[model samples]
Target: ARWSPSGDRIAFVSNSGEGSEIYVYWNTSNTTSKLTQLENGPSSISWSPDGKHIAFTMKVNAKAPVIASMPAKPKGAKWAKPPRITDRLKHEADGAGYLKPGFNHIFVISSEGGTPRQITTGNFNHGGNISWSSDSKNLVYSGNRNENWEYDFRNSELYSSNINTKEITALTDRNGPDYASKVSPDGKHIAYLGYEDKVQTYQLTQLQLMKSNGENKKVLSNKLDRSINTAIWASDSKGMYISFDDKGKTKIAFIDLAGNISDIVENVGGTTLGRPYASGSFSVSNSGKIAYTYSRPDRPADIAMVTKKNKKPIVITAVNDDLINYRTMGEMEEVWYKSSVDGRDIQGWIVYPPNYDSNKKYPLLVENHGGPILNYGNRFSTEIQLYAAAGYIVFYPNPRGSTSYGEEFGNLLYNNYPGEDYNDVMDGVDTLLKRGVTSEDKLYVTGGSAGGIMTAWIIGKNSRFEAAVVAKPVMNWISKTLVADNYYGYANSRYPGQPWENFENYWKFSPISLVGNVETPTMVMVGMNDLRTPPSEAKQLYHALKLRKIETVLVEIPEASHGIASRPSNLITKVAHTLAWFEKFK
Candidate 1:
């Protein structure tokens, strides 16, 4: 709801079975009506100060997908004619291909109702969390429009355009990445996160501020030893609220124009999902009330509301209540251990089987996360829960390269991954065994993407695991670089030299090099159309296992991409097959 210039009608987007439409309920008229007839959908709606028009982001499906012709119709007496394929890359995409062709950008529609006008254009994709100027004369957005767009993943910049004139202007120019730009309520200053490129494993982003015209840029919380998650401009426009993590816990902080920082809430934001690694998001109302995503050890992330007057937060969304009533899922507990290689403390989480008992021993499934850079924080994850509910103890750890920790700790595996981090996982397993929570005899391991790569590496180096499943892994670095999407850029950044310059280095770190020593009964899974890891990587491992006459199976998820388990049905099947493979050995 938007406060009239004086403050009254709240305009909101509602789905009425047809599709998502915008509706403005007036305070005086006590009436409402549809403002748009968009075929796709619209979201991120904001009001103009004068209440004359509403600006929103619309997703339009511009073209129908193309399909490849299959074998001639099989001996059918009568059959419906086949449709022509219009999209070239339709079948190649898992779920994303089915989506309409379009990019998210600003669109202005009369608050009363009419046709909506698209404002921003180009091939560059716009970032979310958009905001409007106080006067509603302009709109601000974040996107990376570098010359090498596909390869430049960390070069997003802030931009602003006139509502009527459509004059676009670049806000900030930094060597590193910048994003999450928010305009102050007064429309005088902009707040965003920026970081310098250090060629390290992960970029350390700092809170930064500048004038609306992108002048006089300065860092606000440079002294703080944490990366800013997101920031919101205060109501008075004098300061802003920021979120960051320290010691594996998330905290909400307030920063003033003078660069002073104060912690408002500590250990507050964590959505109920996997092990808690610091995960949550907050949105502040004009009145200073903060609504955020909250989670606990046993639940997934839900909406929570917080105010300065009430020191405690109130739960706003209870999504897991019904699910929990029908079936009990395993609860997660945070576990920490010192790495055997460096003595550095490593953090991980353990999810025991549902209705767990200490007297009975259970099989352990060590799951690795993707990104190798992304943290497996406490967030709602269906795959992990499904494994736990299937009577397997799941273990997920934030090895040396995981985020939430400081830069020094995260960069430990920049160019050197699957190295000491391997020891980190082994040490975690030993710690659980020492605590009598897991047995070495009934151990299995699995992971996807980078985690999948590690799984292949683990089975090659050790015979401790009885069974293993590696999903969408990069078996050979030399072939992976040419096959994967954004191949040139990712390969250049992760490795010190090109494939020709340092052939031995790539072979030294690749898991496929050690496939000859693998003895564990392994199962390989991957999306048939995955561009990131590609199917050939999985094929290499499958062929090697078959050549050795070892017990192995290769399951290819059809019409899926790098993220094989994106769809609800695919996720269910992914978990079921993984559990079935492990159950065979058990």
Candidate 2:
């Protein structure tokens, strides 16, 4: 709770009934005054070098859901009034059933309470890492402003703008995404991560440096082909620190202006909870002191701080200390196996149930990750832990398209996903069975979104699983292409041609095509407002199962999105419902 610059006062966020407000606490006067009174929450407050104003992001009220015009009162003389037309979009939302109109944008306000001025405007959503230039006259951020913003997930470019006039200028124009840009301390250079674009997938993101005005761009880590997760400027601005994954381990490295790459630290833990994937985040102070979240196999993620002189790190957050007495947690162990389809080494993790006895057989739950492109690494995941706590052995693998394995390994399933990756998952399950960690009769499968599609596909191809829970799955490519959030991207990248041109390929990979072979009791769940992997996808699979008289049930989480378990209450319900479904089969 220390103030920056002169340190006369500490600036922090204060919560009230309406929302969170920024406040500055004067140490001498022992008084607090509000800096912002935004209706929505304010965060990432950065003080100006002159300490006159603070820059932060705030959510502004936007357009409300539109309601279709209702037919004039049915010419009925007895009707007192015509029924009001409620918004369909509101009714379709999860949890809240409808959304309160809001859009996130960057804003600046005085350190003392006053009217906050909006600095940027557009339909495109913008909020993530934000930083101020050395002169404190400009703001830098990353967001997508393409014409087709809804379907352009990979087109985010770094942008900078003058705070006074709000005149924006693009810093990088590339086919692939560029994000996490930070202006160097001296204000001459900026560092960020970028990669070449491939259809439907992303490559290993490398650290790049460019002048503040967007000239002389060059990749700093050309020799280090691994993806650079994040980059931060050093105190002197002569060099910058970066984090990347080597194999499955997270390493912190530094690169000087001359492009000399040196590993500053390695084995910095942070992937806790589920599998041991390379995941960690670090923030450096102006004094070169680094604070990071660190984790180990036996523990969850915790904050730690380190300095150059004192290489030894100190844990700041004690989340694990409170859970040490709990006996229901599982122990995650990294596992490696050769793919049956090919000799490629597949990496995954096995979570053994607490109080597990080798003599007794246990049920196994194969969980698929959402992003076929995103990796399921050794990061802390509450969803996986709850399953392990329920006496179920959980297996989460990176499959073929998962990141951190290199560009080639990640893009292996590019246009051919659910093909080789499917074999890789099944082979991993077989390997686990051979290890005697799971029984065939007690095996179950479940995943949401991309993983959901895989779960449905698995049951369609094989009846090995006793039961399956497919959450927010895609059943029809044609329908998905038309209705999904990123409809254009999803359809264009997965299929070589349009639906009419490549109907056979779409059907060949779709789970609905093989629904007739599904005999296992399946439970399908979807978020009512999920634009990505819309609920209609799950309904198709459920209706198909019902038509064939297969044991099936469809559960819709109202007011939720593809990320249905984002809320704590919803997470509990999701876990409870999934466990109940598996228990009924057991």
Candidate 3:
């Protein structure tokens, strides 16, 4: 959905199916009209400031490449299908699978209704967010329009396209990515998020500003340590509203030209249901009002707003009230402990069971978070809460490589992942154990993706846990580095070079390398179609455990991608299977 410049109308596609029609709803008249009927639905919709035209990006399919073909069969006979051919570095994604042979091009349509006109051309994808200049004569967007765009996937530059002439102009020229361009209300400057390529595991995305024509680029968020996720210009063009994760919490703040940030609100997430990674979006209205998706530990997102008079936000909508009000949720608490490896203060969250008894001894579940770069904050997580409700004190920590902590902390895993980050997780566990939270025999560990890698590493490193559930993990880095859907994207940044060039470095960090030492009762799980960390990775662990004569089981979810929890029933299946497996050892 895209909001009109006057904020009086909202343009949205009519349906999710193909051939969806764009419809504009007028707030003043409470009327709606079909704006356009396109074959494929439009995305990245943006309205011109003058409220005259709407710009969106759409896929324009290209003819499939054909090699040698068999002779044309008779009309009645249906011969075998032709073999598909692909020579691209990234031909398929985890969820999207193989992509259509086409490029996404920008198209413009009248706000009223008209045939859309394509502006940008060529084989490059201009599908990123579209922002308009204040004058409404030009459109700004991000794309890798380079000749070597497919290979240099990490690099992107901002481009400005004249609506009438269809002339494209590059506005950024850095080795790293420079995208997410947001032109100020006054059209004096353009702000974006990017960083110089350091060829490292992680880099903080800084806020940068330049003149409308892309001159005099300067980093405005140099003083801010944490990466800024979203940036929106103030209505009056004084400062910008930015959302970022600080420590373990997500915050919405205002930053002036000098980079001084004053927080407007905290808990700016609830959209990511599977895990509590940083997520959410906010936008500023003309009269100094901010609307955002409100987040909390007890519930998912609800519509919220804050005004200049009331700096504190007001939750205006209760979308989850029916489900949340009736449920007795676990209590979540945050704690900070020093890392045994470096004496760094590591933060983690403890979710206590519902109606807890201080006298009772509850089993502890160490639920490691994915990303290895993403942090698990004190936000609502149905998965973690489910574990807590099942009578285990769920402890999720933001280890050394987790984000929101400065760039140094997040990039510590460069060429050393499953490295000290493993110690950071164990240190949190040891701290809780020393406080008599749970004994060694009652411990259970589980995590998916990167979290799964850490969980496998944990159980292999020690025999304290009663059982372990390693879901969709990279058991063998050498295999996974070349096998996953994002295989080409992890080479130099993750390690020093290609897997073959740095074979020892890759294998050294793999959990499969430590599989021989694992003694915990294990249940390895993965989505059957998980391309990110494919089902083969899970089977490697299962086969190894079987050969070792260890108590183990394999659970493969069918028709699921890397995001097994994307479907509600799939989420239930994952949690149910995890509980059933953990229940066995208990």
Top candidate on lDDT is 3
* Residue 63 local lDDT, model 1: 54
Give the per-residue lDDT of model 1 (tens digit) for 192-291. Answer: 8878776666767898889888899999887776788888888899888888876556777778899888776654554423333467788788888888
Model 3: which ten-residue window has the lowest total lDDT? 13-22
What TM-score do all the candidates reach, one by one?
A: 0.83, 0.84, 0.97
Best TM-score among the predictions, by candidate number: 3
True lDDT of residue 552, candidate 2: 93
Q: Which stretches of candidate 2 lie over 4 Å from their true place?
A: 1-3, 7-15, 19-21, 25-31, 38-44, 57-106, 118-128, 143-153, 164-169, 245-251, 258-280, 308-312, 326-328, 497-501
**Over 4 Å off in model 3, which ranges?**
28-31
Ranking of all candidate structures by their lDDT, best first: 3, 2, 1
lDDT of 3 by residue, 519-540 (tens): 9999999999899998999999
Question: Which candidate, 1 or 3, has the higher TM-score?
Answer: 3
Task: Provide the lowest-lDDT 10-residue window in model 2.
Answer: 86-95
The digit string of per-residue lDDT tens for model 2 on 129-211 reads: 77778898998888777777655666788889798989999998888888878888899998888776766554778888899
In terms of lDDT, model 2 sits at 0.79
